[model samples]
Target: MAIYSSTSPKFFLSSASTSTTSTTAMSTTKKLKRYLELDSSLEDEIPSKKKQQLPRRTCLVCDVEKGTNQFPNHKKVSSHEHDHNVCDPCYRSHLENEIDSKGWNEVACPECSITLTYKEVKNMTTAENFAKYEQACIRATLAADPDFRYCLSTTCKSGQLHPGGTDEPIFRCEHCGHKHCIVCEANWHQDQTCEEFQAVRRRLHAENERSQQEVKKLSKPCPGCRVPIQKNRGCDHMRCSRCRHEFCWVCSADHGLIFREGNHRHEKNCIHYRANPRAQEPELPRHRIERMLEPDTRLRAYNRGDLDDSDFDGSDSDDSDLDDTEPWDDEADLPLVYEPDLILSEVRRRAPGQTLSRVYVG
Candidate 1:
């Protein structure tokens, strides 16, 4: 019997593989031989390496090695320490996204704070995107100019530089067709000069200040709810709005128990306890303080027939007599009421309407 060791199977397998390869080896060998011979036939085939393609660079953005042909058309993004480049695809996407969100301001590198100028970015992006960027640049440039102004109307979004500026205050917005004052920056004040309008505004502002002071002086805060309550035409006894808690208007002491128990007992220190609040203090409308703050205007109001006897005390309408509430004598109270009819009648009754001339008050 033949010796059958473990190595006998391996020997048989190797011999079978060698026989199979020998048949195919000649065809592969002949092709290689012809290639070498044809290339070297005319001159010695240069001992050379494979043709080198474009140098690959690692992209700063995607961190992928890409050929130089796949870079953006612009120069390197950063000049300083951050000297790296982004791939073409990543660079385009970043530029478009920035233009959409932040506009063409400081478009920095993808991986660093090295910002590029707007012009540099413009050269790298598509034509459509460049148009939008150019538009934004134009808007920014126009906005920086001081002469160019936007229409103040909320409904209109148009503006132009006025040829005569504040020298011609009345500016009619062409878009909205509403006239406004460029100097005052307000709606056109018809039939009044700008100075007159400004004087009226100042007078109104003073009146408002006086009115606020009068309200603060007259109105008292509810102790229970802490809400300001004005007893314009009510008794000293008051009630809160939402809480409905009865309290004293003058002293703000709780009066819930008195109302509930039917006994109107008040704190002895309160003004209501001593005397009737209505009788102690005169019932004057709080706005009279605002109307009378301009003491000079009081005499003018009386002379203009705007002040009525019932509206104020019968005292002389003079700055010196503001504190004097004493009633005037009968003759003084009836002193020539300045009526327009009386003014015309006095002029005519001078000689009983012989002839009349139109008199205008400027």
Candidate 2:
């Protein structure tokens, strides 16, 4: 048996494998170098082909290289370092968005933050957008102007371009044929000056306020027509002239409770009737009260033969002259005299069985 050392065989095998790997690597490297040298020689032998170039541009917005024609009439921003170009569509869109969001006053380029001139913006945007920008500018200018006035016509709200320091009170609308006073903001008053018109307006306002206060104080809506009824001085047995609906003034019910019949007889369940039983008593006939209070009126009624103590029913009297819907305004002309004792004595004397409990004089 030949005793061969294990270490020697292993070392020899390792050396052989290393040599093979080195040879393969050297061959691959040489082939690569030769290919490169061949490519360089070919380049040197043949004239370099002219490279074809296409007209191109870079869009600042999208950051894409597009054909130069794609940016026709495009916006450009020139700085010290470089010039920035934006495509037509992108530039128009940016202008429209800026005009819409920031309005005409603050419209600016999104890229360069440069404020665009009105002419530049108008040329870039659409017709509709340009019109909107123009209108916005007009509105802003008018708002800042102290002399600016809008037409008072509902059909046409066109602005009136009144020059500053013009003392013209009347302005005629060019859009609609309506003339109005600028100071009062009302229809033109040919008879009155601006000061007079304003004074009349103030007086009308005061009268309206006074009327409203009177309505709230002395008026109640009718149950049938819902029209406000003001009782200046009348019987509790109220009749709505508009709807012809009869009701008690004290109870506000459709019950037949004459004011002359006494307040307790009106409606026991009514809040007002229960609250003031004596105060809500039936009123005396207007004619009789007038006769008893005013001797001159009584003599006039007697001369006309319209006054009869026995058959003097208020319903029979001609109330055609008086409007039931309106309160009696002539109360100021009449004397404020309350002779309850005299009225009750007269009532007792006229009708023995018809006893008078209370009398309310307004």
> Local distance difference test, per candidate?
0.64, 0.67
Q: Candidate 1, residues 92-150: lDDT per residue as tens digits?
A: 78878877887557666675656667766765677887788787877777777766666
Candidate 2 segments whose C-alpha is farther than 4 A from its true place: 1-65, 72-82, 101-103, 134-149, 157-166, 185-362
Q: For candidate 2, report its TM-score.
A: 0.32
TM-scores of the candidates in the order shown:
0.35, 0.32
lDDT of 2 at 145: 85
**Candidate 1 Cα errors over 4 Å, as ranges:** 1-52, 63-65, 73-84, 100-105, 111-115, 174-178, 187-362
The Cα error of candidate 2 at residue 109, in Å, is 0.6
Q: Report the lDDT tens digits of candidate 2 across residue range 66-173.
A: 866566343433221234377778878887888788867788765667687777777667788889899989888886887777888888868767664337777887
- TM-score, candidate 1, is 0.35
